[model samples]
Target: MRFDELDSKMRIYETAADYCVLPGMYMVARLDGRSFTRLTKDVCQFEAPFDTGFRDLMAETAENLMTCGFRVWYAYSESDEISLLFDRDEQLFGRKLRKYNSTLAAEASAKFSLLLGHVATFDCRISQLPSENLVVDYFRWRNEDAARNALNAYCYWTLRKTGLDEQQATSRTCGLSVSQKNQLLYEHGLNFNDVPAWQKRGIGLYWEEIEKNAQNPLTGESVMARRRRIKRNFDLPMKDQYDGFIQSFFTRSPSRGIS
Candidate 1:
């Protein structure tokens, strides 16, 4: 048999099951770190629950994905996960879910490995939101998760620091409500409300506009021009306020800042 004929036969097994996202769907690619529990806590020894270094690394990695290929409009990160929002009209790789999944996971893993100076991996999945409201709900879900995780972290670490074993610490926080967890931190002289907003609510990355005065070389005239730039927001709002925040980015096109 000819090489080309044999190759055609084998390629079917590789490409036959490929799936593409349907048009008119808003796609959110979420990447989560694999085995990060062991990797961050045991191997790397990042500070328990949260570490500034780890947080910053995660932010940088998320930023990398934004500038990567697709026209990412919004990026959100919390815990060991990242979620990127792409325009509904995006047509990259013919909107193949497999391509987005593989490429994003590979890129995230590679970037993290480079930054950590060790091997790390990320797995990505796509969420096809039918409407823009779902996108807002999706991020609101993550933001709430960050708040819950933050409370659990502070509670867990407080117990651990009090000489409880990991198992004991986990067991103690099992039935605690959000208030109880906050009280736990309070009793330990750590105010949960005073904790950094990024720790409790996650951080948001989106575009903003800046204006600058420019001079026309020939006319010797000055003018104000607007440009778009990506801004990292640590103080994210919540509930309806947050919905309003996300809505502004989608609505306001005339106010983009100078990049």
Candidate 2:
């Protein structure tokens, strides 16, 4: 076969299942650490339940993803997962799902592994939300999930610290209610309410405009210039308040679809 013909034939096999997100749909890419339980607990031996170092690593990885070319409007990181909300008008790679899944996973893996000085990998998937309300609900779901996971982590670790084996600790917390979990931690002299808000609600990142004092190069006159930067929020609100936080990113007028 001719080289061009052969190339075209092989390319079809690679792209046969390619899918693109439709225009006007909100795209949220969620990247989860692969085998992170073993990686963090066994190999890296990070402090169980929560570690400030590990948390910072995840936050930094999310920040890298936000600035790595795509127009990410917001980022949320919790546990071993990072979620990025892309601008509605982002048309990169023709909005192909495979492009996002592959690029984001690779980007996160590379960035995190470099930061941690070990090999860590991440898997990514894109959520295509049809309406603004759904987007708000999606983040709310993750926000609430962070709270649940934080409670369980503290409870599980507390049991482990008090001589409970892995199986025993798991069994102890299995059917416990949220209040029960809080009580368990309270008995251990840890107040769930006193836990860092970032640990419970996760961290949020968004771009903000800030003014900088500068001097004009030619005139040497003082001037104020505005620039955009990624701002990290460790103190995220909860429930309805969080919904308002996510909705704030929708300030831009909605685009009907790709032109």
Most accurate candidate by TM-score = 2
Model 2: residues >4 Å from true position, as ranges?
252-259
Model 1: CA > 4 A from native: 212-226, 254-259
C-alpha lDDT score of every prediction, in listed order: 0.87, 0.92
Top candidate when judged by lDDT against the true structure: 2
- lDDT tens digits, residue span 16-78, model 1: 988888988889999999999999988999997789899888988998898788778889999
Please report how far candidate 2 places residue 20 from its true position, in Å.
0.7
lDDT of 2: 0.92
**Full-model lDDT, candidate 1:** 0.87
Residue range 120-172, candidate 2, lDDT tens digits? 99999999999889999999999999999999999989899999999999999
Over all chains combined, what TM-score does candidate 2 have? 0.96
